[model samples]
Target: MRAISTSGSGLVDVDVPEPQLRPHDLLVQVEAVSVNPVDVKIAASAGDERRILGFDAAGTVVRAGPEVTGFTVGDEVYYSGDVTRQGADAELHAVDARIAGHKPGNLSMAEAAAVPLTTITAWESLFTHFGADAGTTGTLLVVGAPGGVGSMLVQLAKQLTSLRVIGTASRPETRERVLALGGDATVDHRSLAASVKDVAPDGVDFLFSPFSEGNIETYAEIVKPFGHVVAIDDHHVDVFPLKSKSIAWHWELMFTHAIYQTPDMASQGRLLDETARLLDEGRLRTTLGTEIADFSAAGLRRAHELVADGKAVGKVVVTR
Candidate 1:
């Protein structure tokens, strides 16, 4: 099988053996994949043993494990594969069926590929970590709201909950994109505290920080007393400041269920299934901002570069 693997901070084409499937796995023929910040990080940290670096994939099931019940051969699916194992950068890939979902019929393969990882991250951040539901009513301030996860987060919060959604974006174009994705308002992230306070005078009830490194103080100030903060980035942030206001701090990682083989691992599949239905119903939409024409080493590298530059408005996808 042909694939792209990380090689000394870059990607290179390689011919590797086809992936072996486990008892609950699905053998998928790769159709499209999306690039995320994690892909860039893993590529830069590549060791002596080269590793394939893709997670968001939309593909067709060629074979399903005997234990699989949710899907079968010829099923089109989308998923973010487990980071503990090989990824979906190859022509054919193996993924656990419990973590995969049926692709939204209205979406193209590239568009479907752009949704899984970001959707999972945003969904878990809002519902799983923050414990929000349709009846939940409060203000949600989303930091970095024009990125892949943020784009989906704003939409889901607006569509599923009664919360007022406010997103942060520095540039005019990005702020417009956030508003287009259903954010009630947009604030400049450059002057975050003041901007957020201008729109949410009483302070927000919840804060979602995709970039949490240096904004702890701002978060403490903007979030109201007894408010909640959910972060997804891996920065060493001290949350003690939030303790004074009884603010609860939580972390969300989409890979947790698959990495630990959690009891509710299949819940991710169900979440994605619901996301697909929303997409098909036109309540939600794909965030595919850029699409590479083909799944070549060069195209993958370009996609990685776009994501690493940190300026792309939404998700960047590469189609096979």
Candidate 2:
């Protein structure tokens, strides 16, 4: 099994033995996987070099554990894998069935792999944390709308919510993409507070960002009183200054359900299923801007560089 891995020192591609399957796991023959910022952060930050870095994956089931009833051999599945175990960087991965969902019939493997991580983040941030109104007349400010999670956030907001959708981007290309995806307005994050003020005279109802620091304070200034903030990255930023706006801050980590083995671990599976339906219905699409072949040291390195530089407008996928 050829797979990319991060050792205690650096990332490398190696041929490792296939993984062992647990009673509730599925042995999947991975067809495609998507790279997110979390993968790079883990590779750079983890002290262990043996760490396998990946989260979003879609593949065909080769074996199903005895207790798993959600899928069978040959079923096409997609999932945002648990962070505690090895990932789907290899041709084969033993993944928990509880976190897997049926892949949509209309999408290719690369497209399917892009949905889990970003969709889960957007869904959790908007509904679970901020309690966005799908029918509200308020505004949604998706800062950096060209990002992996941000791209999907715009679609879900437009399709699932009536709230006015505003997206921020520094490039004209990204702003055009955002508008094409149903963004009602576009702002330049480089302009910071001025951008937000120009787009929203009243204020934003929700502020969603997956990018790092420097924009939080400016975001705080544009949000309406009682507006909610949902951040998905490990910005580790301070929000004490936002108290005056009476703003509420929320953090979303897609790995939470599987990482904690939450009682609703199966809920992640359910969310992906819903996303599949939405995709086939033309209500949602993948944010994958780049696609590479298989997990190798070279491929993983390129993926890491894109995320680390914050130049990726959409998710990057690796295909078998």
Candidate 3:
């Protein structure tokens, strides 16, 4: 198997023997995969160690473990493989069938590859952590909403809920993209809180953070007294700022379920299934911003570099 491995010093493309398939696993012949911030962090933090760096994968099932009954040979699937497990940056990867889902019929493998990671992060951040009612009437503010997860979150929050979506993007181009993706309105992130207040005078009912900067206190100010705030990044914000307003704070790490092998570990797959239905119905869309062919070490490095610069909107896909 030809895989991209991360050595202690840097990433290297190597040809290693294929992995064995477990009873509950599915052997996927990866056609396309996407890179996330986690891949960049792992690559930069690698110290005298080698790792396969990738997360979202979409391809065909070449073989299935005996216990994998839902999918068989040649089934197209999309999933974000577990971080602790071997990733999908290789010719072949054996993923737990419980985490992978059937690919949306409407999208190409490259397009499908872009969804799992961002979709899961956005879905979990908004619904799981913030207790957002999809059917309720209110306003939702998505910080960094033009990025991959934010793009998906905007569409999901709009389609599945009555909430008027306000997404922040500092650039005029990004703001256009956010609005095109279903944001009821768009605001420049340079002055985020005030920009949002202009859209909804009362206050935003829910605030979702996908950006690195901005204080939680600023979010609290724009939010209503009992509003909910959730972040997906490793934000080290002070708790005191949120105390006075009685605002709820939530942090979402998509890897937590798989890393801890949580009791509802299979829920990731369940959500993918639901998301697939939305895609096929033309309700939700893929966030693939760009595609780098070959899925080589150099290509992966380029993708990571773009993401680390913190300007990439939507998702970056690399095909093997």
Candidate 4:
């Protein structure tokens, strides 16, 4: 099998044996893959052993294990594979059936590949962590709203919840993109606290910060008393300062369920199924901005470089 494996700080093409399937796994013939920040982070810390570095993948099922029931051979599926296992950066990949979802019929392979990791993060952050429900009337601020998860967050909040959506973007073009994606208002991220206060004097009801680190104090100030703040990024953030306001801080990691083999591992699949329906109905859209035509080591290395720079507007996908 042809695969791109991490060799030190970069990727290399290697011909390796196909993976062994588990009782609940599906052997997928991968057609497309998306590069994410986790890929770069993992590559940097990887040891001498070659590591496959991808999670978001869209492909067709070639075979399913005896315990698999969700999909069959030739079924098109998409998923962010479990982090504990090898990734989907190869011609053939094995993924747990419980975490896989049927791909949106209207989307191409590359488009479907772009949806899983970011969409899962956004869905879990909004619904699970922030506790956003339909018909809720309040202001929700999405910090760093032009990136992959941020774009998905903006659209989902606009379409599903009644919360007034405020997105943060430092540049004019990114701000415009946020507005087009259904943000009720856009604020300059450089001037986050004041900009948020200008829109909601009392402070926002919910805050989703994908880039929360040094700005923890600013977030504490802008969020309402007893409000929820959901963050996906890993950094040193002191929540003690937010105690005065009674603000609640939540962390969302998309890999938690699968990594632990939780009882609700199947919920991830359900979430992706719902997202696929929304995409097929045109209520949601893909954030695939840059497409790399080559699916080789060099192409993946370039994609990793762009994502690591932290300036890419949307998801980067490579197609076979």
**lDDT order of candidates, top first:** 1, 4, 3, 2
Candidate 4's displacement at residue 92, Å, is 0.4
In order, how many clashes per candidate?
0, 5, 3, 0
Clashing pairs in 2: 6-49, 7-48, 7-49, 8-48, 8-49
Tell me which of candidates 3 and 4 scores higher on TM-score: 4
Model 1 alpha-carbon drift over 4 Å, by segment: none
Which lDDT value does model 4 have at 163?
88
User: Model 1 Cα RMSD, Å?
Assistant: 0.9
Per-residue CA lDDT of model 2 for 1-320, tens digit only, reads 88878887577878889899999999999888888877887887778758777889999999988999879999999998988899888879998998899999999999999889888888888778877666666888897788878888899888887888889877888888999889998987778678777777777888887664876677677888888888877767988778898999887888888878899888888888899999999889877788887467787787778778977777888887
Lowest-scoring 10 consecutive residues by lDDT in candidate 4? 44-53
User: In candidate 1, where is summed lDDT lowest over 10 consecutive residues?
Assistant: 40-49
Q: Provide TM-scores for the models.
A: 0.98, 0.94, 0.95, 0.98
Candidate 2 lDDT trough over 10 residues, lowest sum: 210-219
Q: Could you say which candidate leads in lDDT?
A: 1
* Better model by lDDT: candidate 1 vs candidate 4: 1
Q: Quote the lDDT for 86 in model 3.
A: 78
Query: Mind giving the per-residue lDDT tens digits that candidate 3 earns over 215-254?
Result: 6667767888878888777766675677777888888888
Rate residue 60 of model 4 by lDDT: 99
> What lDDT does candidate 1 reach at residue 161?
95
lDDT of 1 by residue, 279-314 (tens): 999999999989998798899999998988988877
